[model samples]
Target: MTASMTSPDTARIAAITLTFLLAGTVKGVTGMGLPTVAMGVLGTLMLPAEAAALLILPSLVTNVWQLLAGPRLGALVRRFWLMMTGIVIGTVAAASFIAGSGGVWATTGLGAALTLYAASGLLSWHFTVPPRHERRLSPVIGVVTGLVTGATGVFVVPAVPYLQALDLKKEDLVQALGLSFTVSTVALAIGLARASAFTTTDLTSSLLAVVPALLGMWAGQRIRGHISPATFRRWFFFCMLALGLQLLLRHLI
Candidate 1:
């Protein structure tokens, strides 16, 4: 469906704006959630493709910030190059499959991923990757992340957990996620373009949506100065759990 197929009313416009703001704030605080949260909310108001379309610019912009804010970019890239390559390849290969499966598949896949992610976070579950496995596992995890992103327009599953398992320093870890997410967003854009899900109207709306995201990111950063991110992170995951349930219900019903 095109933007012309679903004209945005005042309610949808407002919903979209607020959703991006909230998603961006979460990203600012935790270096994640712009895509997951935005899609969770926006999917309710529009076609899943349209909601995914709206994510392009905001995901790219916010994730760029997340990517660049950390230290030693060159070193990080060197470390994760094989994983990055696999992400690109997996996304490109799976895009057409997702397009054929239709949006319902994407929605369900995203919901399942969010449910698993939130449940894991809520349980405070952690995995440790043995040093021997890191070499073999990184590319596999990267490929999995790319496949999920290709289908769902959300990319915070095995990838995030895999990164956490590495036990990186706080700064390094944040930057690593940023880099992975940045790559994911770029790959998603390519996939959407090939699928013809991203149109000019969506691009315009996506660009316009960037304002709220940046403002929300700023606000979240300010809030970070005042409150503990641990609290925010807990709430964020719970909120994801709710959104995941909603998505599942919508699709199942």
Candidate 2:
């Protein structure tokens, strides 16, 4: 009875680990996409709430690592403080309604986010936010991004596009992304906890998935120079686009 009952769980855990491994590798090579890819892939296997619960630990740890590894943490924080605050507010406000729904709405929203993200990548779109505009727009962008994160557990969309438009030095941009993602992850975690979605088994599974995430990152770094990031990104976005469309169609149909 024990083995029989445990079998499905064991397989599910294995699948979770592999999903993070792949997601982490993408983050390693491209410097982002961990949550987007993980949520996208896992959406196929489980409810968005369940997937969000499993995502907490690995996403938090990895984003923290990324946050600290950068050179301009202090300045990034000072500059983006308002935006982060907006993220907290927006996420907290929307969490109950969006994540708690965890049904057709959440699934459809996730699909929409993935499709938007993938479309941006595939188009190689470039946007520029001027310094004067940054102050005015950061908070708005944060709130919108948080709403999306709360709904879909993916925090890309306008936040990334806005950040990219900032015209920071490459390293600073990377660090900024880390800071934004870390804040978003923490907020999302809090929202999940408040929603009572993090069961003990799910928490353990989340913690265990961190190992595979790290391992995948290491492997991706080793192979980074050998593989063309551009080519890989094209393929990755294509896959995400297809998966996103599938999710939307599955529930709608």
What TM-score would every model get versus the actual structure? 0.93, 0.96
Tens-digit lDDT track for model 1 on 1-253?
A: 6766566665677888899999889887877888989978886666666787788899899889878888778999999988887787777666655555555776777678788889999999999988789889989988988888787777787889899999999899989998998898888778878888777887999998999999999988888888888899999989999988887777688
Model 2, 65: alpha-carbon shift in Å? 0.9
Candidate 1 error regions (>4 Å): 1-8, 97-100
TM-score for model 1?
0.93
The numbered model that scores best in TM-score is 2
RMSD of each: 3.1, 1.3
lDDT per residue as tens, model 2, 63-110? 888889988899999999999998888876667655566567898999
Clashing pairs in 1: none
Model 2 weakest 10-residue run by lDDT: 94-103
Q: How many residue pairs clash in each candidate?
A: 0, 0
